[model samples]
Target: MFYEIVTSPCYGTVEKVAIDKDSRIYEWEPLFAIKNMNGELEVIKMGCSGEVQSLEVEAGDKVIPGMVLAYIQEDILIGGSD
Candidate 1:
């Protein structure tokens, strides 16, 4: 599955990118973090295990809540269900 990861609810400027494209990451892993307009840090986490497919935002980029940050292509589990 192609999964999209968005920024946290707190609007902010991207302070850092914790992962890179094609990087393998586990579920709940830290994908990226943003520094809110209020100077608070917000971390966006991966919801599933997968390889990073793309990154839409970079460090120092301005971002808002729910902004697309990156894409993750989740591992396929074939024959796992009937």
Candidate 2:
């Protein structure tokens, strides 16, 4: 298994945090709801299947593109490589 870092895709205020530390997550699962500078809401999704290692942001926090949001312990399949 490998570690993956989830990042913010835009400048915004974090409206909601959908997962907690140590929670299991899957690819494309909604992770955060952010209200951008334009007031448009955006859902942030996980990029891979994993257990969340830690969270770097919380509700009401301001975030910018490329900001680290969480660290995930990525899942690894046996025999077949990712």
Candidate 3:
């Protein structure tokens, strides 16, 4: 099973897959600014606000949507390892 990791639609750019010994993902930044007919400075901050959790699946690991990836629990529960 393969899980499709996707970003929210609110994100203007899609994450790019980096080909390297250590697979890294990155997203392109969009240029956004507010200006009148005449050049003027304006506040503009465009980007996604969230954390990308590290997945349990490695380079060649098979994973399903419902499969347990990683625990984000505040307290470690005993006998929780499956």
Candidate 4:
């Protein structure tokens, strides 16, 4: 198992948090809602399915491009120790 970091793609304020710690998330699932600088709302989605390990930001938090939003823990099937 390994962790994947979820990052923000724009400068905005977090409008809503869609998942909680330890929650399971699916690919393309909504993770957060952010209101961008131009007052446009953007819904951020998960790129891969995994269990949420931690959340780095919350609703109402300010975020910039490439900022970390959460950590996701996923199983890697290619290599494993039995």
Candidate 5:
């Protein structure tokens, strides 16, 4: 099953894509800054606080729902033997 992650609070552009499966970190990067509710600009590191499987799109990609931007490789075995 694939999930769609929306852009939170609306921002300029996506800087990077982070992938995480089953609470395990797979990839990460520094994302572009976004203006919060308080009107403050802030750059958020992708997947800094939550478990993400994979990013659907890339940097500067216009995104919408029902779009298969990226994919998550599920069923990864432990001990790095997949």
Candidate 6:
């Protein structure tokens, strides 16, 4: 029923992509691995269970905090909606 965009938690360069577009991912699933400025791998996690709509960044791409990496589509059950 809504979309959730996954973002980088800190300034870093995208090191790896663990998921692809149209991929179904669960809560806390790793979306990407980023190498921080201090040379650390930070694994970004999905906050909700949904289907990946798109990937906005690729491996070796620079990123900053709040930079969107991918979009997730999650269905919200309404009150007896048709």
Ranking by lDDT: 2, 4, 6, 1, 5, 3
Please, what are the lDDT tens digits per residue for candidate 1 over residues 1-82?
5565655577788888988889898878877888888788877786688888888989898887677888788886678666
Error of 2 at 10 (Å): 0.7
Q: Name the regions of candidate 3 deviating beyond 4 angstroms.
A: 1-49, 69-82
Residue 46 error for model 3, in Å?
18
After superposition, the stretches of candidate 4 with alpha carbons farther than 4 Å from their true spots are 77-82
lDDT of each: 0.79, 0.95, 0.28, 0.93, 0.43, 0.91
Q: Per-prediction count of colliding residue pairs?
A: 0, 0, 0, 0, 2, 2
Candidate 2 lDDT, tens digit per residue, 1-82? Answer: 6999999999999999999999999999999999999999999997689999999999999999999999999998779666
- Give stretches of model 1 more than 4 Å off: 79-82
Q: Is candidate 1 or candidate 2 better by lDDT?
A: 2
Task: State, as a TM-score between 0 and 1, how close model 4 is to the true structure.
Answer: 0.88
Weakest ten-residue segment in model 2 by summed lDDT: 73-82
Error of 2 at 34 (Å): 0.8
CA lDDT for candidate 4: 0.93
- Rank the candidate models, highest TM-score first: 2, 6, 4, 1, 5, 3
Candidate 2 clash pair list:
none
User: How much is 4 displaced in model 4, in angstroms?
Assistant: 1.3
Mark the regions of model 5 whose C-alpha exceeds 4 Å error after superposition.
Answer: 1-15, 20-56, 76-82
Per-residue lDDT over 1-82 for candidate 5, one digit per residue giving the tens place of the 0 to 100 score: 4342434444334444444333433334433344444556544443433345655456555433344533333333348555
The TM-score that candidate 6 achieves is 0.89
Error of 4 at 14 (Å): 0.1
Residue 24 in model 6: shift from native, Å? Answer: 0.3
lDDT of 3 by residue, 7-67 (tens): 2222122122222222332333221222322344222222322223443433333333244
How much is 63 displaced in model 3, in angstroms? 1.8
